[model samples]
Target: MSLINRLLLLLLACAAPLPATPSDLPLKVGLIGLDTSHVIAFTGLLNDKDNPSHVPGATVTAAYRGGSVDIPASINRVRGFTTTLTEKYGVRIYEDIAKMCEEVDAILLTSLDGRTHLEQVRPVLAAGKPVFIDKPVAGSLKDAVKIFQLAEDAGVPCFSSSSLRWYPGVVEVATADFGELRAALSYGPATSEPHHPSLFWYGIHAAEALFTVMGPGCQSVVATESSGAIVVTGKWNNERIGTLHGIRDGKTSFKVTAFGTKAIVEQKSGGNYAPMLREIVKFFQTGKPPVPAKLTLELYAFMEAADESVRQGGTPISIPDYLRRHGQTR
Candidate 1:
C-alpha cells in the first residue's frame, strides 16, 4: 500500500467511534407488573437522566401490565401507572410477558399479588434472564420454594427482597457501629392482603430488616397477636433473638434496635429505593444476584412460620418443620 493511503486508513480508524463495550452499552430491562408504586419509583430512578441519584447503564425499555383484578389497590391504579410509564417515560407496553422478555436483557417481577409470581416468573426463568422479584416472593411458602427451585433448575440467577433490607440506617447495624449483633427488634406497618399470608404482604419489610440485622438461620418462630398488632419472635441457630412487630392500626413506623457486643444501634431513619436499585443494576450487569436465593427462601420461611404460629394460637413453630411440611427440605 502507498504511504499516503496507509496514513489515511490510520486516520479513519482513529476517527471512527470505538466499538461499544459491554459496560458502555445500556442494559434493556423489562418490568413484569405495574400495579405497585415501585414501578414508578424504580423506573424514575433508572430511566430519568435528570435525577441527581439516577443510576445509569440500565433502562426500563418495556413493561407488562399484570395487575390483580380482585385487589382494589392493584386494579384501580394499574391503568394510570401503565399510562404514566408509556406517556411520561416513553416505555413500550406489551400485553404478553414473553414478547417483552424478548426485547430486554433483565426482568423485574413487580406484580403486587404474590399469588401470580410463580407463573409470571416461569417464562422469564425459561428464557434464562436474570430476574429480581419484589417482596413476598410468593403467596404461599410452597410456591416461594418452587419459584427458587425452578430458577435453580433452569440455572438462572434470581433474588427477592424488600427495599428496607438495604436501607442505610438498617444496613449500618450490621457493621462495626454495632459489632456482632446479638439481638434486634424491628417494627413496621403490616397491612394484610386477603390473598396472601398476614406477614407476607407488608410485614416482610420489618421481618427482612430483622433478618438483615440478625443474619439467617432462624430455628423457630412464635407469635402473639392482639386486635391491632402481632409480635413475632425468631430464635436463630446461634441463639440470637430477633423480634418483628407488625402494627395494623394507628400510626406506624419502621425502627430497629440492634444490641451488639460493641455497641447498640437504633435505626429509625428509612432509605429510598435508589440504594437498592443500584444493587439491581449491578446484579443485572454481572448476571449475579445481590441477595442469595437460599437466604430469600429462609426469610419467606420465617414469615410462614410466623403465620403458622398465629394459626396455632401463639405456639412456637419450628422453621425446619415448616419447610419440610411445605416440601422444601433444603
Candidate 2:
C-alpha cells in the first residue's frame, strides 16, 4: 500500500467512535405519548447531563407519537412536542408502538388522553417492559382495573401516579409523627374533560395527595356540587373521614391538610416532575413499583365513586360497589 493511503486509513480509525462500555450506558427508556409537555420535560431531565435536576440511570432513547384524534388538546400539541423531543433531545420517533417497545428497557405512557392509555400501553406490557402510566391511569375505573390485571398476567412491572403525590409538603405531612391520624382534606384544580369521569383529568392530582396521607381503605364516598366546585367526602373503613374539593370556580391550587390526634399539617405548594422522574428511574432499574397496585385500584375507585354520587343526585356511593362494577372483589 502507498504510504499516504496507509496514513489516511489510520486517521479514519482514530476518528471512529468508541464502543460504550456496559456500565457507561444508561437504561433505555421509551415514551408512548408525545401530546403532553411531559414528553419533553422528562426526556430533558434524563438525557441532559448538564440539567441541574437531571435524574441519572435511565435515558429516553425512543418514543412513539401516539395521540387521540377526538381530543383537541391531545392531537393539536402532539406534533409540537414530538418535534421538540426529536430535534432537541435527539429522541427517535417510531410510528409503531410495539417496535418502540422492542428497542427500550422501559416505557412511559404520558399520553394526555386517559382514554388512550390502555391501548397505548398494551404493546409495552406485551413486550415485558416495565411501564409508568401517567395521571388518570385509564379513562374509566374498569379500564384501570384491567390494566393492572394485564400487567400482572404479563409479569411486567407497571405503576401509575400523579406528581402531586410527591410534593415535598405532602411527603412531609404523610410521614410525620402525627400520632393517630384522623382525617385529611386535599383540594386542587379539577378541569373536566367530556370524555372522562369527574376527577380523572386534573383532580387526580389532589386525589393522589389525599390518598398519600389517608392510605386507602375508603369505604364510602359522596359528592356535592356548589359554587362551581365539586366537593367529595369519603369514609374510610377505619371510620376516618377524608374530603376533596375539586375546585372549578377560581384560584385553583394544590393543597393538602392532614389532621391527626397530635397535629394538623398542610401542603400549600405545587409539585415538580423531577421527583416523580427519580422514582420512575428507580422503578425502571429495580423492576419494583413504588406504589402498590391494590392501593392504586382503591384510589381510582374512590374517584369513580364520587362521580357516581353526583349522578345519583348527591347520594352516598359505596366504594366497594364501584370496584365490584368493574369485577374487582376489593
Candidate 3:
C-alpha cells in the first residue's frame, strides 16, 4: 500500500473507541530527571492536568532529577519552578530525594542518557526499587552492566526502551514468521556532533529496533570504512544485517526487512516516543520489564564493539569479551 493510504487506515484504527479506565491500577510514581528540559516529557505526562489519563492514580508529588545538584537552586529555585509546573502543568514537586523514593512505589529516570544517569540511577538501585530508565542507560559498557546487574542482584524490575520497539508496522513484520532470514538494513539520522559520543548516544536507538525485530545476541561488528558514520553491521541469530548512516540531515526513520526463503516483508516506522511511554506504563501494570536486564546488557556490548572497531582502524570487533564474559548465561 502507498504511504498516505497506509496512514489513512492507521488514522481510522486510532479513531476506534477508547476504553474505560481500570480501577485496580498501581498508585503514585517518583520521577527522577532534570526538570524543565528534555526530560520534561515525563513531567508533561504525569503532572500536566491537560493530560488527565496518564496522570490518573499517579501523582509525581516528589520530583528528583537535575534540580538536585544545585543545592540552593534545588531548594529555593524549585518552589518557583514547581509553582509553574503545578499551576500550569499540575505536577507537584518534592524536595526530598530519599523521601520521594521511599514514598512512591516506582521510579522513572527521565534523564535517559549520559554519565549522570549512572549516579542518578545509583540512588534508585540502592533503595532496591524498580525503575524505568530512559534509553542509552549508560554511555559506557562497564557502567551499563554495573547498573543493570545491580538491579538484577537487588531483584528489582528495571526496564528501558525506545518507542521504536512498539512501532506497529515493525511489530507486524517481525511477528509474521517470515520463513528463513537473509539480510536487513536499518538506519536513522544524527546531529552534526560526530565524536560527541553520538554513536553511543543515538546509534543504539536504531540498534534497539534492529535487535528487537531480529532478536538480540548480535556478534562481530564492522563500521563503515569511509564515512565512519557510526554504521554497524553484524550477525543477529542466523541472519546478516546492517545499520546505515547516522549523523546525517533528514527526518528520523527506521526500517526492518526479513528476507526469507519463502517471502520478504518490510516495516518502516518514524515515530517511537508514545509507544515507549505506553510500554513503561504497561510494565507498571504488569511487573515484567519489556526488555530484560540481560538484553540491555547485550545492547551495551553491541555499542562497545562499535567503539572497539572504530579504534582498531575500523577492524571488525568480536562481541565475545567484555560484559559478554560476565553477562547472564541463563
Candidate 4:
C-alpha cells in the first residue's frame, strides 16, 4: 500500500471510539416489579445515554413483572410498564425474582403493593445482593420490621425510602447551617390504597420528609383525623416536636418548615428521582445503605402509631409501646 494511504488508515483508527473496557462497564441492575411508574422513570434515567441527567455506571438490564392481580391499579398498569421496560429500554423480562437476581449485580424492589415486598425481597437477600425497597416497605409495621430483620440476618445491605426524602429543598434543609432543629412540620398529599394501611400508601411521603428533618427518636404520636386532613404530631425523645399534615382535600404539595436555633427555614419540594437513583447506585457499588435500618424502622413505627392513635379516637400512642405490641423493640 502507498505510504499516504497507510497514514490515512492510521488516522482513522486513532479517531475511532474505543470499546468500553471491563472496568468501565456499567453495573447491571435488575428491577423486580413493573406495576409502578418508577420502573419506567428509573430505567429511563439509567439506561438512556442521551439523557442530560443520566447517572452513569449503572443500567437496568432485566425486570420481573410481579404485580398484584387482585388490585386493578396493579394489574391494569403492569402490561404497559412491562412492555416499556422490555421494548423501549431493551430490558429482559424475567418470570420470577430469583431468576432475575442471578443475572444482575443489584436489585430494586419496586412492587406497587407493599404487601408483596417482603416475599419479593427474600430471595434477593438470600443471594446476598444489595436491594432498595420503595416506600411502604411492607403492608403493616410488623412485616416491615421483619423484612429489615431478614436483611440484617442475611448480612445483605437493604434500605427503604420515599423519593420525597431526596427532594433538593428537603435535603438542603436537613444539611443546611440552620443550627439545631427545635421543631419541624411537613405537609403532603395522602391518597389511601385500601390494600395497605391508611398512611402507608401515600402519607409516607410526608412522614419521610418529617423524619428527614427531625432525625430519629420519636417518642410518641398523637393523631387527629377529619374529612379534609389528618394531623399527626410526634414528640421526640429530646422533647423536640415534629408534625406531618396529610392533606386529603383540595390541591396538594410537599412543603416543610424547620425552626432551628440559628435560623428558620421553609422548604418546598422540587421533586426529582435522579438524586435518589444516584444514591441507590452508590449503595449498590459500596454495599452500604444510605439510610440506616434503625431510622427506617422508627419511621414506620411513627406511621403505625398515627394509625393506632386515630383508631383510639385521637389519643396519644407511645412509640415504644406500639413497637412492642407489634413484636418489635427499639
Q: Pick by TM-score: which candidate is best?
A: 1
For model 2 the TM-score comes to 0.92
Model 4 TM-score, 2 decimals: 0.93
Q: Sort all candidates by TM-score, best to worst.
A: 1, 4, 2, 3
Model 4 lDDT tens row, 91-119: 99889788888999999999999999989
Q: Count the backbone clashes (under 3 Å) in each candidate.
A: 0, 0, 2, 0
TM-score of each model, paired residue for residue = 0.94, 0.92, 0.77, 0.93
User: What does candidate 1 score on TM?
Assistant: 0.94
Which residue pairs in candidate 3 have backbone atoms (N, alpha carbon, C) closer than 3 angstroms, thus clashing? 33-65, 34-66
Better of 1 and 2 by TM-score: 1
Model 4 ranges with Cα > 4 A deviation: 1-21
Model 1 C-alpha lDDT per residue in residues 65-114, reported as the tens digit of each score:
99988999988889999999999999999999888889999999999999
* Candidate 2 weakest ten by summed lDDT: 265-274
lDDT of each: 0.90, 0.89, 0.64, 0.90
Task: Write candidate 2's Cα lDDT for 5-83 as tens digits.
Answer: 9999999999999899866679999998898988888998899999998999999999988888998999999989988
Could you give candidate 3's per-residue lDDT for residues 1-330 as a string of tens digits?
999999999999999977755445445677775433434556566555676535444445556645544334233454455555566654555565566778777787765334556788777777766788776676576777777777777777888776577778767767767776666566765442232255666666667766776676676777653443567777665655645455445466667666666778788445535566667766776668988777777766776677677778778777766565645444
Extract clashing residue pairs from model 1: none
Give lDDT: candidate 1, residue 4: 100
lDDT of 1: 0.90
